[model samples]
Target: MDIIRIEQLEIFAYHGCNEEEKRDGQKFYVDANLYTDVMTPGLSDDLEDTVNYAKACKFINKFLTENRFDLIEAVAEQTTRALLKEFPKITKVDFTINKPNAPIKLPFGNVAVSVSREWHKAYLSIGSNIGDKEGYLNQAVDMLYDDENCKVGAISKFIQTKPYGPVEQDDFLNGCVEIETLYSPQELLKAVNAIEAAANRTREIHWGPRTLDVDIVLYDDEIVADSNLFIPHREMHKREFVLEPLVQIAPYAINPISKKTAEQLLDELRGQSENVNSGCAGCQGCAMRK
Candidate 1:
């Protein structure tokens, strides 16, 4: 990653906690580091291949001047998000807002807030086994697409698969979704849970019928294991429904823990299923020929 630095770009903005400070705008200095690949521009010497610092500076100036916030922290956060969105080439940003005229009774040199933000690639597994199964899955996808912090990418074809777990249930419509999001793993979990709730998903019985089920299968090759959530989904490798559609869209996606690609995992799972008894305890769907 290459960095394009914007240092101490001064701007007068009305951003502060006090009313007087908002009324009498103060001078704010902004520093930003835009992270992107500059190799193409370096070799070609074409301005189009690189992020234009001039344009970026102007955008920062305009954004800061136009927006009114109560705190410099908000300024830094919003500015970082805006820069990432405005310049598609920049994948990450480190931003700082310096306020020298802060209303401190005692002498103070400066007050500043700095923030780092970047987009993360995440894979989500979506399924529905109840009424309006397809509708519920589509609604989940639409909810993710509607979120400004998330960019929905390739989606796998929906496939019907037998239910998992001991509880009897109807077949499920399962698929995977690829996305680039600004939310952290926990935040993304919250977002997906909200989407499921919107579809009237219930949790009465384990692996029982439900309107919608959204699971975070993978997030940027990250390994997360917590009480509430697990990345690479704890049982994804054993569940054909997850790997089947996941392979369709992200065949090369690697599991951080297993260090195996989606294709490799799926192949291994299928090979094991071939030798095992047809009647599997966990997921009968795997035993059924696709």
Candidate 2:
């Protein structure tokens, strides 16, 4: 990764908590470090392969001048998000906004807000066992696409698989989705849960049945274990329903816990299944395989 630094670009903007500061306006200093691959541009001397810092400076100035916010935190966050969205080559941004004229009685050099934001790769296991399973799955995908904070990447072919757990239920139409999202792990969870709720999913019975089920299978190379969510999904590797479709789209995607590829995980699960019951009659002819 290469860095493109824009240092101390000063602009006058009306952003402050105090009414006087907002009305009169104050000087705001912005510093940004854009992370991207600049090797090709450097070697080829092609402007197309790299970002134009001049244009970026102008954009920042124009944006800040046009937008008004009560807090510099908001300014920094909005600016970084806008920059990342506008420049496809920029992978990450380390941004800062300094307000030297903050309304404070005590003498202080400056008050600043610094933020870092980037797009994160994530994989999801989505399925539905009741009521237009395929339609429910497609609806989920569409919701993800419509979200401004998320970008849909590769989607695997859906496979019908027998349900797990003790609950008696119909087979599920299962598949995996690859996405690049700006939301953090928790925020992504909330977003997906909202989508599920919109589809009328219920949790009255544990693993019973639902109109839709979406689970975060992976998030970049992160290993997250919190009270609410777990990354690399606790039992993903053990389930053929998850690994099969996941391997189709992200075969080389590594599970941080086991450090094994999706393809390898699928193979290991199949091997274990073979050892337990070699060529089970139930699996001989399945619609999921088609």
Candidate 3:
């Protein structure tokens, strides 16, 4: 990634722990490294092709002066998030705030705080079997798009599929969504859970049915396994509904654990299903058996 560097841009701000410091204010210097693709601008020689550093600088100055915080750490954190939001081309930010006149007894050259933040790519599997299945799925997509921390990307067309577990239920409309998110895995889980709750989903029976269901299928090729969540979705490879929709949007996305692409997994799953349906006596690993 190419970087646009902004070094030591001075601003007068009121951010400190002491009462006197907040009242009197202080001079703060901000340094930022904006990570983005500048090759388009380099080739096209157009200002619109890349992030406008001048405008970014103006925004930084205004935000620092306008916002009041007790810690320069907060300043760095908030500024980084703001920059990422304000400049869509900027995928990541490394920000620093220097407080030269910190109220310390010992003489120090400077006190500063730095933070680094970036967006993460995530895949979600969404489904609904209850009332207004398609409406519930659309609502979930709209909610994700409306979230400031998420930028919704390619979405697969919803497909109707039979329910997974033994508990008898109606057919489900399933789909997949790709998103660029600022939230970590845990936070992303919370966000999706909130969406499910808003759709009036209930956990009355395991794999029975629901108004909406959302699962974190994958996140930045990172593996996560815990009591509450599992990345690469524990059974994504075995489920045709999840893999079919996911392959539509992200056929090349690889399972971190198996290192197999979505397309490959889907093909293998279909082959297995064919074998089982054909009564292949040698096949011992059929999904139907389990």
Candidate 4:
């Protein structure tokens, strides 16, 4: 990883809440550090392999001059997004917008806002047992792609699998998805839940049946233990239905601690039952893979 720092680039823009401030305009100072891997460019001495800071600065400057906003926060956010959009090499950014002359009469030094944003890798196990299963899955894929924050990376072929839990439910059609999203873990959870609800999925019976079932299987290299949700999905490894499809898309995704690949976990869980000893604390890969 490497850093490209742009320090205190001053610009005059008409972004403020107050009418007088908007009309009169004000000086805004922006500082940004673009984090990314520069090894490729450094090795080859090729501008194409890395972010060109000069070009990037020009983009940021032109963008602020063209777009109008009402807050420094908005300016910072928009600038960060614009920079990232222009340079795909950027991994994360720490951006700051400073307003040295706020309208208040008080003698405060300055008002500043800063935020960090990075791309997040997310894996989803999507399935539908009722209605047009493939259509439902494709529809979900389209919805995810339509979101600005979500970029569909890869998708595995749908697999026919016997239902888990009560076993009386219809045979499920399952598969895996790989995505790069700008949303946080909690935000992604809520978004997927919203998608599920929109598909008219019900929660009346546990594992009974559904129009669409989309589960968060992984998010980057994170491990979570929240009551509402868990990442590396609490049970994805042990369920052949989950592992089989996931392995197809990301066989090399290794568990952070256990260091097992999805393919290895699938091989281990071949003849096992889905619910047998699958718990969050003991999972070497997916919580379900314990």
Off by over 4 Å in 3: 281-290
lDDT per residue as tens, model 4, 117-191: 888888899999999998888888989989877879999999998998965878999988899888889989998
Give the per-residue lDDT of model 2 (tens digit) for 1-290: 79999999999999888889778998999999999988999999999989999999999999999999988889999999889888888889999998887888998999899999999999999999999999999999999999988889999999999998999999999999999988899999999999899899999999899999999999999999999999979999889999999999999999998999999999988977885686554453554676
What TM-score against the true fold does each predicted structure earn?
0.90, 0.92, 0.93, 0.84
RMSD of each candidate relative to the true structure: 4.8, 5.6, 3.3, 5.5
Clashing pairs in 4: 234-287, 234-288, 235-288, 238-289
Task: Rank by TM-score, highest first.
Answer: 3, 2, 1, 4
Report the lDDT tens digits of candidate 1 across residue range 1-290: 89999999999989988999889998999899999988999999999999999999999999999999997888998889888888999999999999998999998899999999999999999999899999998999999989989999999999999999898889999999999998989999999999999988889888889999999999998889899999979999999999999999999999999999999999999977875766555556755755
Global lDDT of model 3: 0.94
Instruction: Give the lowest summed-lDDT range of ten residues in model 1.
Output: 278-287
lDDT of 2 at 106: 100
Q: What TM value does model 4 have?
A: 0.84
List the global CA lDDT of all models. Answer: 0.92, 0.93, 0.94, 0.85
Scored against the true structure, residue 119 in model 3 reaches a CA lDDT of 95
* TM-score head-to-head 1 vs 3, winner: 3
The candidate scoring highest on lDDT is 3
